[model samples]
Target: MATLLFHLGRASFRFRWFVVLLWVAVLGAAGFAASKAPTPADEGFTMPGIESQKAFDLMEERFPGAAADGASARIVFIAPRGEKVTAAGNKAVVERLVHSAADGSQVASAVDPFQAKAVSEDGTTAYATVSFAATADDLTDASKSHLETALDKARDAGLTVEVGGDALATKPSAGGAAEAIGIAIAAVVLLVTFGSLAAAGLPLLTAIIGVGISMTGILALSEAFGLSANTGTLATMLGLACGIDYALFVVSRYREERAKGRDPWEAAGLAAGTAGSAVVFAGLTVVIALAGLWVVGIPMLTKMGLAAAGAVLVGVLICLTLVPALLGFWPNAVLSRGARRNSRRHRRKQLRTENGGSRWAKLVVRHPLPVLLLGVVGLGAMATPVLDLQLGMPGDEAKATSTTERRAYDALAEGFGPGFNGPLSIVVDAKGAADPKAAVATVSKEIAATDGVVSVSPARFNQAGDTAVFSATPSTAPTDTRTQDLVKTIRDERADIESRSGVSYEVTGRTALNIDIAEKVQASLLPYLAVVVGLAIVLLLLVFRSLLVPLKAAFGFLLSVLAALGAVVAVFQQGHGAELLGVESTGPIMSMMPIFLVGIVFGLAMDYEVFLVSRMREAYVHGDAPKQAIVSGFRHSARVVVAAALIMIAVFSGFIGAGESMIKMIGFGLAIAVLFDAFVVRMAIVPAILALLGHKAWSLPRWLDFMLPDIDVEGEKLNRKREVAERVPEPVG
Candidate 1:
């Protein structure tokens, strides 16, 4: 693997312009493809085999073209508290808005508030429903503009008018400010680390190139695979972070080689051989972990994972090939003046004193038990809140306050109940039943009497009179536990309702679909964790050539992940500082967060593990004592690990600036996880535990060791050659 990577680097240098031009051509192709790509709407959450999903399918079949792929807009009109919407002028204004909305190109139909009896009992508020021909995400900007223009008339009439509903809920966010800030911080960190404008810019430039290609690829893939809208944002986030970090690793190594007096081309090749191999392995770990999301069998999550993984893969490839070719283009500029001066100073002094990581390693050697205990205790504290973690999906309420969906949601909640925003569809299969209309009416009446049900609409039978649709509003909010319980209660009555009315009942709608998704995800959580963790263990075992190493890594990383989750739970779920963070309300964590976090965090945590432990193992293999090897390895690898961790934390933390609460939650979770894992687990606990284990940390049974392939990820042979080159004495002049 090392030889292959080295030759690949050498060839890239030999044909540097060709390599650079090839990437430029790829970027051009990606841009052109992106421009022509079809935009796919968000598939949302799905659990295909679940009862709620079955119910949804039944409804779709019975009422084809019934806004199945579209969303309805709510045109809310609120009068002054002292005034009644029933007043002649106020009602007229609302009717005018409704009529205008019905005439809009996007609107399939509109329900006049007066006709639909949608006015609140207090008569201060009324809302009309405007059905659209396409989902909120599928609607073009022109269509939304026309719809908004139509709704603008109500506001022009001196009444408060706002548009809300699925059409507005899934609108694309203008959230690049946070991401831009993240990239800026990353640039600063790189500049500080490299202390040279040219050196620092290389990583940033490479990252942008890679991310650009990956994003365009995602857009193109969405045309066919129907990726969720969030995929592009997430892929960009991971792509930039990983691209810069991977390039940083290789560039740092190249600088180190140059410091040792190797020519630029040779240094680049050697750096690629060593650091490039590690980058490949690290990236593969991340991709494999993300790909594990497919095991959950959720289309949205699966595509998200694939998109992110694909982006990271592009990052890895760019770091290995394009970065080196760029280095070859201007070899002299790769070394900063500060680095050169430091090399001269270091050579003159032949410094003997240990740095912080080495000193910490020595402390661990002296007192392993205490260090290990302290690290574990700290992680345990952070992990405590995870026990109280609740998982459920958020709704439009979680969107940014500036969003039309958020304003509309607030209006609906104030005028009606919170449940008004998420009504459940009760689909009745009255086929072959005597008096199908009466059967549907009986079921509707029973549903209205249910404990959690707020109201039930009159049954609307299909053209065949065999299927009926009844809208039911729950008393609680959409994401509320009681709302989910209401879904359960209604579904539980399926048998009783079926027996009494001779009509089968199924609860179906966005609210019920979300509930079902959560339930299905929760049921599969443990199995998914097992699969990801189990696969990580096997992969780590092969790389490290030790059973204990993989076990410790898997277990410790899981602890770090749990600690991160606990932090999110404390901040978001427990509402400890939610208001300060701009979150509107406390609610359950997103259902898919834990799954996504586990896959992402585990892979990221392993990246540091590979970089740190691989060096330690290299030293141990070269005949250093376990304690000495730990110190030497850490002393060398600590700077890069710290730099990389800081970059990741900055990038992730910046996302917290996003307006959407769910995005903030995910950002906070990832940031916290990286911080804990890198600074706490990898830097402290890992060294202590390995110090305690000594030689056993790398121990494998003789039979198993023989069966496993020997993997030299750090290019030990190249290291040996460099050592020899540095040691050879010049002829006495």
Candidate 2:
């Protein structure tokens, strides 16, 4: 593999112009395709086989136009203190708002608060329901404008009005600030690491180019593939991060080769062969972990994972080809001032000096037992919060307090109870009953009598008169554990209800759907982890030719992931230090956050493991003692690893500035995970454990070693061939 990569790198460097032009042309083609492509679809959260999904499908089949799938808004109104919304003036204001909303474009109907009995017991609060013919994603701008105008009029009439619901949900536009900030931080880190402006800019340039191509391609193919509008978010985040990191690795290696007196062309080839091999394997691990999301059977998650994987693949290709080609364009300018002025002997002397990495490595090796115990105990303490982790879908309640959605959610929860924000739609099918009306009435009564039932709306029959639909509100909040139990209780009692009432009913709607999706994701977590972890272990075993190293890497990954999750729960769930991070409200963490953290962090954790451990393995293979091999690995690789990890951390932390809660949670979790995995697990625990294990750390079973193919990740074979050719004197040519 290394020999093949060496030739490929040399050829690319030899034809640098062609390599550059090819990428430019590809980028142009992708941009053109993106320009002509249709707008991306908005496929909201969907679960195929869950109970709520089945109920939704049944409702659409039986009730058609009346299915609870259309966009809806709850416009809550509160009168001034000592004033009742039931007063003549206040009532007129409420009625006017409902009428105006009903006349809005795409509006199906609007229910007056008085007529619908939606007023609070005190008559100071009321809410009107407006239903739209289209889904939230399909609502026209004119519809939103009309609603906003009506809201303004209501506020002018001395009534406080706020709106919440699917109809008002808008996808936040990406302002590009986060990406810019992340890039700026990465540039500074690269500049410091490389100590040369020319070298520092190469990774940024290649990363931006790779991101442009991948993002444009994703946009171009989105409509055809039914990708959601948010699909490119993960793609962009991972692409910029991995692209820069991959290029950083290759560029660092090229500089190291040049420092050893190798010429430009030869250095580029060797760097690509050695460092690029690690990049390829590291990229494959990420792709495998992401693509493994397919096993979860969630369409949205699958698309996100695949899109991110594609972006990482592009980064790998750019590092292998474009990076070396760029190096061929300016060889001496890439070296730092100190490196350029130093002679071969001086450079060699500098390389042998004991650096900070070597000093820290020696310290850990000398006290392996204490270092390992400290790392384990610290990570374990951080992971304790995971025991109390609660997962659920964030609703308007979790939104920023400044948002109208959150204000409305608060008003409704105050006036009509917390359950008002998340009502469950109950669909009763009575076609087989002797008397469908009687069956529908019986079912509604049974549902209203359920333990957690706050109230049940009057059942409305479809045109066929065999199906009826109503809503049931639980006593607890949407994300409360009791709400989940209430949903389960309803479903569990369905059998008895059906037998007695001669009708079948199912619970669905936004609330029930959230519960079902959370449960489904939780159930799949273990199996998904099993698949990703097992695959990574096998890949590591092949790369390092060892069992203990792979096992140790996996264990370290678990510690980092759990510790990250614990941090997320502490801030986002328990509300510890939430104000500093701008979290206005806290409850359960996002349902899929755990799985996402596991999948992405696992891949990235292995990246550091492979890059760091491979260097040690190479040194050991070349006849260094185990302790010295550990020191050599840190000396050569630790600086780049630290820079790469910091770049990733910056990229992810930038997303924390997003207004969306889910994006913030994802960004924060990933940033924390990288911090723990890179510094604590990889830097601290790994060397200590390797030191304790000594030579046994690199041992593999004879039979397994014989069966596995040699990947040549360290370019050992290429180095041997080069050594032999150098000694042969070229036949006097």
Candidate 3:
């Protein structure tokens, strides 16, 4: 294995240019491909039972230009009290709005006249919609112009207008914007932790490349299989988290090698073999955890599952391959002179502990219960807020991060009856034997009886014989307490109506959608959490050949997540630090956030746990006391872990500004999860526990340790220098 790694290291130096060029070409190709890839905005993937997707697909088929590609744009019009929405107002503002949808100075085509449908029951609430000429996926100059005209006219009209829907929702911001923030944060953190920008940039570059490939590849597939727009952001987070994390593993190894005065490429290869193996294993575990989304039996989850798994796989592969290859090209200057010197200083400083077992191992031998108790108590505090968690399904405006949206929602809620902004739909299908009129009447009476419901509109039959749609107004705005309360009331009452009224109907629209999604998500929450924890444990055990080690890792990861979640729950869920993150108190956690949190948190926690224990295990195998090994491993990997986590936080935190509520929550949850794991859990608690556990951590029975084959981290690095000198080309990154 050592011989192969040595050869691989030598080959990397010999074929440095080939590896570097391969990256440039892959990046170039990805960039070009991404340019052509359509943004999936609002489109979702193949989750079964989400009839909304099917319904929308059918709507698109019926009205080819209206709902085919993306969600039809929702334009909300607001007129001052008692201002008759004049026909002039409708024509000059609403009709004219469809004429100027275009790029700068160039008009494309006006919104198709058939596309504009009047959407108000009375004159007070009015709207004109402009459907895209083609699918949002197939956006063209003509379609752009139509959308622009609609937006411009709405702005030009006397009424306040807001353009929303899935198309605009999926807009990918500057891809580089996320990368830049990630890089900047990574660089500063790397410098602070490892104390070198050059050192930081290598990992940052690797992570960026990985993220690029992930997003492009996922999006490209989205075109074929119909992935969700939300998957785009998810891919970004997973890619960055895994990418930087993998690099940290390699970087720690590289530094460890350099400390021994090894050549740069030699150290890089050593790092790849030593830390890289753990990276591969950890990455696979995360991929496996995310892939469990498939088990949820929902298309939305399935789509997110595939995208997340793909992103993690790409990240892991990049870190293992491209990062090692890229490191071959770094000059000795790659490490700041001080870092090199410190490397030497720290190396000798630890000679007493080198391959001599972890300090944690010794501590565990000295006192096990104290360490265990401390960890449990600390984790208990963090888990406290988790018990108070409430689930909420916030509507469109609740998803907005815009100050304007904020001010508007607030003013609307305060000024108008909350019901005006809370849009809920109750549909009766005659095909299902539901009487449209009777169902509508029953629905209306039920809604009116609901404390928070303020108004129930007369039923509007889209299909005269069987299908009818009716609107309901809650006593509060979409974000208001009353509106959300009404959603719960509607859902709770659904069963009774089904039994008594014999009317089978589905309630949909923004508010009901939120509520239903939240309820359904929570229903399956336990199984998902169990699966994630189980996967992490089983995967780790298979790699380590020790039951205790995997359990410890899982416990550490859970603690890390619960601790971070508690803090955020206190802030966001419990209303402690909501103002700091710029989120309004919604009184409950968002429906999808927890599921998303488990995926992200488990991935990252596994990352640190893997990095830390891999080294500790290595030291234990080399005959060091376990305490000495744990503390030493902690010291060695601590800097890189902290740096990697900080970069993740910086990149994710910027997303809080994206004007999407769910996205911001994801960003915050991830940032907090990483920080907590890197610092308190992995750094302190993990070490303390390991300190208390001694050889029990690495102590598998002779039968298991001897019988279980040791997993090689890096497939033994092959000495391909002789072959590489012949100028063999490298595969694309």
TM-score winner: 2
Best by lDDT: 2
Identify the superior model by TM-score, candidate 2 or candidate 3: 2
lDDT for each residue of candidate 1 in 1-733, tens digit (9 for 90 to 100): 7767888887887789999999999999988988898776666556777777887777778877562657778778889768988999988888877787777776788998898899988888888888888776667887777777866777787888777766765544333687678767877888888878888899989999999999988887776877766777667777887888789989988887777778788888888898888888788888888888888888777888889899999999998899889998888686777455666665653355477778877877789888889989888998899888778788877776777777778888988988988899988899999899899988999999999898988888778789999899998889888898889888888788788888888888878887877777878778878887788788888777899988999878888998999989888889887887777777889988888788878778888988888878878888989989999888877878888898898888777887778888888899989999999888888888888898999899999988988667768777787689879998898
Q: Write candidate 2's Cα lDDT for 1-62 as tens digits.
A: 88999998888889999999999999999999999999887766677999888888887787
Q: Which of 1 and 3 is ahead in lDDT?
A: 1
Q: List the residue pairs that clash in candidate 1.
A: none
Full-model lDDT, candidate 3 = 0.64
Candidate 3 ranges beyond 4 A from true positions: 1-10, 21-42, 45-47, 50-182, 194-197, 228-230, 263-265, 298-301, 338-375, 396-404, 407-416, 432-452, 476-503, 584-587, 657-659, 712-733
The list of candidate 2 runs beyond 4 A from truth reads 65-70, 134-141, 170-179, 343-351, 730-733
Q: How accurate locally is residue 452 in candidate 2, as Cα lDDT from 0 to 100?
A: 90
Candidate 2 displacement at residue 132 in angstroms? 3.2
lDDT of 1 at 591: 86
The CA lDDT at 702 in model 3 is: 78
Better of 1 and 2 by TM-score: 2
TM-score between candidate 2 and the true structure: 0.96
| Superposed Cα deviation of residue 250, candidate 2 (Å) | 0.5
Q: What is candidate 3's lDDT per residue for 1-733, written digit by digit as tens?
A: 3344445554655687876677678767777776788876664333345433344444344334433333345455555577634455554565555545433223223343224333444444454444443445555555555565566656565666655554344453332465467656666777776556667677777888888877777666667777766676667767776887787677767776776777677677666666767777888888877887766666767777778788788776666566667676664556666555666665456465433234434455466567667766877797799887767655544543453334344444444455566667766553455464676677668766877667677776553345556677776666455665766677678788766666655656666555556666777777887887887787787666678878877777778777777876787666676777666544567877777777777887787778777776766665667776666565566566766777778877766654455656667777787777777677666776666566676667878667666564423223244336447777799
